[model samples]
Target: MFSRKTRLAVAIAAACSFNQALAAEQEQLELDAQTVVGSADESAVDSYRSTPSSAATKLDLTPRQTPQSISTLTRAQLDDFHLDSVNDALKMATGIQVQEVETDRTYYTARGFDITNFQYDGIGIPFVYGNVEGDIDTAVFERVEVIRGANGLMSGTGNPSATINFVRKRPTATPQARIDLTGGSWDKRRIDADVSGALTAAGNIRGRAVYAHENKNSYLDRYSREKNVFHGVLEFDLSDSTLFSIGHTLQKSDSNSPLWGALPLNFSDGSKTDYSRSTSTSADWAYWDVQENRTFAELAHDLGNGWQAKAVVTHVKKEGDGSLFYVYGTPDRDSGLGLFSYPSEYQDENRQLIGDLQLNGAFALGGRQHDAVLGASWSRSELEDISWYDTTTGTALPPLEDWSGNIGKPLNDAGSNGSDFTDRMQSFYGAARWSLTDRLSLITGARVVDVESSGGNYGSDKTTKYSGEVVPYAGVVFDLTEQYSVYASYTEVFDPQTETDASGSRLAPVEGVNYEAGIKGELFDDRVNLALAVFRTEQDNVAEMAGMVGGRSYYRAVEGLTSEGYELEISGELLPGLQAMAGYTFVDITDANDDHAVTYSPKHMFKAATTYRVPGLEQLKVGASLNWQDEVYNGIAEQDAYAVVNLMASYDIDPNWTVSANLNNLTDEKYLTSLYWTQAYYAAPRNASMSVSWKY
Candidate 1:
């Protein structure tokens, strides 16, 4: 795997050199991507609706033209709601569920499956292993784009749920600067600053910088956090048709008394135990610290023949250190004497590198114009962990009625070992959009992947490899009228597994298929967009645990696990000064036996947010958002259906000044973020924040 990636890197370098030479000799052509920015098909910053998307097929197609579901969180929307974290921003996106399983570990799901494919500016490889640790701030992102369904064209692992792409903020042709100061509930305080403009005369060279600092205490006892973020970028226009861009980002978060695991919700009697939202099971000596450094470079060239060549390279380093304590065992309701504490100290470091090269352009076929794209990409991730055990590995704790975050710091009393591993993927992919007729079109793409993983987890030796696996995609769209289109598509993804069969033989990789159809409409002169989509996903070769053999567990391949659902979404300006977005989603999951499966995922969800500029007083805008979902059950516990309301109001003091406020969970709803696990933490209660900003 390593040698193959080395060869791929050399090939990409050669392609970059050729692209640079061609760019220097050719005249500049009309290039929408002269720099790192969103395409014209992207939704504007001031509107809630999007026009077109390239995240799925790499071909610019309007929502009405693309045979899939899409959602976008624009800069305007982010600022309006003060969505400071990536997790917070996704809460407003349609069909998304943010599972906050721990203070630092989170899982995101869409359409009844985990979303493992993440991208930056359309380049893949993010959050390896399907979990978000620590915090991911949104200060440096210009917009967040979501494609809800299988996307095998760009991602190596095409999860049959969704793909998230973050577009970074870039230097602008005109100079601009902004500063923001905010204070919120839970003793939260933050400041952010951003500036972007030219670095030299004639605007041939440009740069942008962003910085943010935050300090806050959580509603939970013994929990607080401090964070700092910085990002800087430089753009060099070597030639009129060529752009070379490089950027670096650093984000660090220090959390005190972070929760390694959640508290059990039930006692030994199988009855529920109610706990206050502020209750915690962390020790005063517990702390978790995380830091990440990211660097990326991009080169784009317009080939003068309407063809464009682009190359992107990204590298990331993340480190986590913590001393944690976990309390386990169902306590006796009468005496609260059954719980025990398990303590440990640990550190981990992860590194990831990815590179891609691609060419896209228009070609003539039978005297008709068509769009095509060819690309290759390679990515590798490595992780190393070191740890030491504690003094209270199995010590019983005090009674629950007197429980508090009071524990002694252990002195490396237990032994520890190293756990190191690596994951690699290399793929070549292509796609084309054929305008078969003026009103009908066909879009097709496929990706061939090479994947491998070798590592030791704790004390277990694991290795998996797959060579030359092909994932296919197909879609077609028929425009019934200038304002409406109907489309259908078949998409697929492959997920390698390590589970072995009862015969001690490795099972085949899991295969996923998605069948989808939808109708989309663009009305009111492209100001409003609406869509209704129905989708069903089938997964096969899923490993199911069989009876233990020789004191070890073996598995058998199971198929027929399926999920089907429909979604309705509408977004845009409903009135001259009113911008709104609303969506409804329904999903049903069943196993091979036709019994409910993954019931933790709500079958029905409705999310809506709208802001209205007061009549004749455009400077004053007020809005409210509501998220409602049906009851959820995880085979162990159940959470009743609930709703959360959030309110926002902002006023423009002047052209250069503004003040805003936000109130969350207005109903103070008490509910778990998820019931996917027997032990889950409660979501936050009512909270408010106020902010002021200045622009120049």
Candidate 2:
């Protein structure tokens, strides 16, 4: 119940009714006098735009001053659109594609490449290989920031796509509380609560806590899930010029009858196969469960004379266990009897500890003042996994038209094997922003890193390490005027691969470089923002799948791959009562052979969302969002361009109470989740959710 869907007819009718909201919006207010007032860590209260962002360089800079493309999903926008999950929020974010490849595993891509770097509160990068195995809730986050293109100065291994930073909410100086209950189609039920305030009489100590729980059935037969998220943080003022903070976050999800892979997209004859959207290839005994725990501590101090020091320490643990069933083979279109099913049991555990120290301040040089930061970071991670299975594997024979999840689970204790790996990283980085003149600035950064992979993983055949690797970053910005600026940047990063070649030898790490230029501006006295950017990226030693051998899949490293793209985005208070965000992206990828490659990634994408408070009715608001992408090919088959519309409306019962409703897939559009492989699945159909919330 991705919030559960209303009955089919009801959902369609309600969604169609919302079409009027978009066409009837009146002229909005433009108050050029509105000013930004808040810390960059916190979102601007009730605004769609952000205050300032350091997502690009550790130094805080306004969007117009940054030399890269950045997008943010703020708290107010999340609440207005009912985006409670990370997947849903990223779906509407500019220039990002949320690929839900399976029931629980998802992949995110931007600018024609996969995104592998993720940050928590601007600290600790979680290393993932294009996929995340469990659901991520937004209840504990103040905002989601996306830095597109290559960013090596911060997120190590600067994958050429994008980096996602989930900023956790901090304790507030004033007391506040909120409770929400939501119900959606497919019997989806969810509850969320958030509370924050000062814990001491003198207000020297503050605490904040958030919790969310959800239970729901899916559009697919025999599929269901339960999820819970809990987060808490405490901030203490050691002195008038110093602060200390500690926090912990826990997220868990358990799913029943989840698919291991997906359905075959083609039959024996090579023609694309068609199945009902509600079809499932899962057995009743299959289940997948995952949990993530994060604990962190941070300290900050003002050293006087415009100098500051900060330190952060963090630990993360993730565990997963699954009993999965996979359907493989090219089934006959008429008989559907050529497919085979295999079942297996898997368990995995991952633990990581990371820490960093940073010192920053203002310095005067030859008649000009500038800002600079120096940092040192270290990280250690260990991973363990096991695969257990029964003996029966290639058995075939079942009628697809009359199949149900009645299969019994096989004893998985027959055999077991696994892998263990340990990895470590150490790096030193520094960056500075020099104001050469009143309208010109120069930004430069550098990182020296040493990384090693000591133990062999599931597919690796040897120990791998890279020492004394250097990543460089440079950018220059020239203000055309007080409200506009033009900038250009160059950066580099490297990524290690886990996939091996036909000889079972690990492939070389991928190295990438990027060149980008953009024009940024503010309108209506900075109430509105606009950006236009173009970028080109080149990579070497990219891993690509090769033929299988001895029951094992292998990959080969390809060199000289290129990707080029452009983007346009605008977000802010277009009017006094109207807030809006819109963006368009186009990208082209060329393989080593100089041909269009990675067809699974579309060449064009467009996303837009807007919310309006009624002019005459101050207590009511309505919003609509659209996501569209051009056709994509999986090397085997192609899917046509598709668009999904979402509508939201809310009424304030009073200052402390409100009721809201959201409808997604308004036109009941049918689409595939992804074309990554020959096996794929359909996305959920039209769905709706209604909620009641109380705030104090």
Model 2 Cα lDDT, one tens digit per residue, 424-481: 8889989999999989999999888888877665555457889988888999999999
lDDT of each: 0.82, 0.82
lDDT of 1 by residue, 1-696 (tens): 566347434534543453344344334333334543421222355588774667888877778878899988877888888989999998888999887878887878888877777888888875554678898999988889889988889787667889998888887755566777889999998878776665554556767788888899999888999989998888888887888899999999999998877777788887787788887888888999999999999988889778999999999999999988777778888877788878878899999999999999999998789999999999989989877876557789886557678878867877876568787889999999899999999999899999887886555555678999888989999999999999999988696654555554556777989899999999888899999999999998765545333212366777888989999999988888888889999999888899987777899999998898899898999998889999997655789999999999999999979999999999999998876555778899999999998765
> Residue pairs in steric clash, candidate 1?
none
TM-score of 1: 0.91
Candidate 2: lDDT of 197?
60
What are the root-mean-square deviations of the candidates from the true structure over C-alphas? 8.2, 7.4
Clashes of each: 0, 5
Q: What TM-score would you give candidate 2 relative to the actual structure?
A: 0.92
Q: Worst ten-residue run, lDDT, model 2?
A: 30-39
